[model samples]
Target: MRVEQQPGFVLHARPYRETSLLVECLTRDHGRIGVVARGVRNERARLQRAQLEPFQRLELDLLLKGELATLRGAEPSGAVMRLTGDAGLAGLYLNELVVRLTGRQDPNPDLFAHYERTLRRMAGGEPLAWTLRRFERDMLDALGYALQLDIDANSGEPLDPSIRYVYDPESGASPGRPGDPHGLRGADLLALAEDRSPDVAGLSSLRRMMRQVIAFHLGGGELRAWRVLR
Candidate 1:
């Protein structure tokens, strides 16, 4: 399939054989795609090297062949973020999440929009924690593994604001009964599910619960960018 001027964002890119590059891009229509940018390493190549960075919108031209496509040309579709300080690190974390979680060539328009919004928020120096958490939840939902947040997973009732609960990665939130593992307070879990800015204590518990859930889906491997951000 040949595509002309498709809107997309570069997820990742690395040097390939000789002067080519293996680029992964997320598109609005085609979802995630892998392309081999031939001769991109040449100094005289028409493609602007700067346009290939993460979070920069681009219009890509390519011809698909099996799993990999041949990039014919590329041009920046909008202004690229010059992320600095903490914001830059947060942007990297977001990119890493997309690279790891999203399947290649799978279309998810909602996820694509959420990702663009997350990048814009990060670049604007907004609070990264809240945005990251919200995006994580949205991403999980888009991938058909949305977390159970409104009611107790075991009890099948609305979460109690006054009681504590255990947030199980496999089963979601449950009453924090005796001998329950991975339990957080019902209030705190509810706060996180609602995307509210919780207090320090609440944030701590929410973070632990989110990390467990994410790690379980990621095959127990930790996000490397998390360490850098910390």
Candidate 2:
């Protein structure tokens, strides 16, 4: 399959053989893919080294068949982009999530859009916490694992903002479970569910809850980027 000038971002890259690179990319229409860019590392190569790094929007020319594709060329499709400090870690964390959860060639246009927007917001110095939460929610929705927020897992009624609750990853929110380590207030959960502004108090709780949810779905796979933040 030959593709030309397709828009994508390198999620990760590493040295392959002497002068080539193994690149993992997330594309607008092709989801996640792996590619071999031959001889790009040589001194006389025409491909821009700047465009091969992760988290930048790139237009890639590729020829793919089974597992890996041959990268014909790549160049930045937009302005230069960078993510540093906490934002960088958060971006990497999001990348890890996408790589782990998605199958090759499984297109999710919504996930791609959310990822681009989150990176833009983070690059612009917006707070990482809210941006991450929003992305996680959108990602879960797109992946068909969205958190159950509108109704209680047990009572089968609309959630009440006044009550305390515990979230079950496979299930949803239920009235507090005894000795439950992760507990959230009904109001905060509702705010997060509604995509409204969450106060500082609610932010921490929501983060923990989302982490638990993500971990459960991932079968406890560790995200090194998340550990760096903690």
Q: State the lDDT at 225 in candidate 1.
A: 87
Question: Compared with the true structure, what per-residue lDDT tens digits does model 1 show for residues 1-230?
Answer: 89999988888899999998999998888889999988878899887666688878889998987988889988888778767888778778877888888788898998889888888888887777777777888888988889988798877999998787877778888777775555677777677678777777666777778888888889999899889876
Q: How many backbone clashes does candidate 1 have?
A: 1
User: How would you encode candidate 2's per-residue C-alpha lDDT over 63-106 as one tens digit per residue?
Assistant: 98898999998878887668987888888888888988888888
Compared with the true structure, all predictions reach lDDT values of: 0.83, 0.86
Query: lDDT at 43 for candidate 2?
Result: 81
**lDDT winner:** 2
- In Å, residue 85's CA in model 2 sits off its true spot by 1.6
Predicted structure 2: lDDT = 0.86
- TM-scores for all candidates: the values are 0.92, 0.95
TM-score of 2: 0.95
Q: Which candidate is the best by TM-score?
A: 2
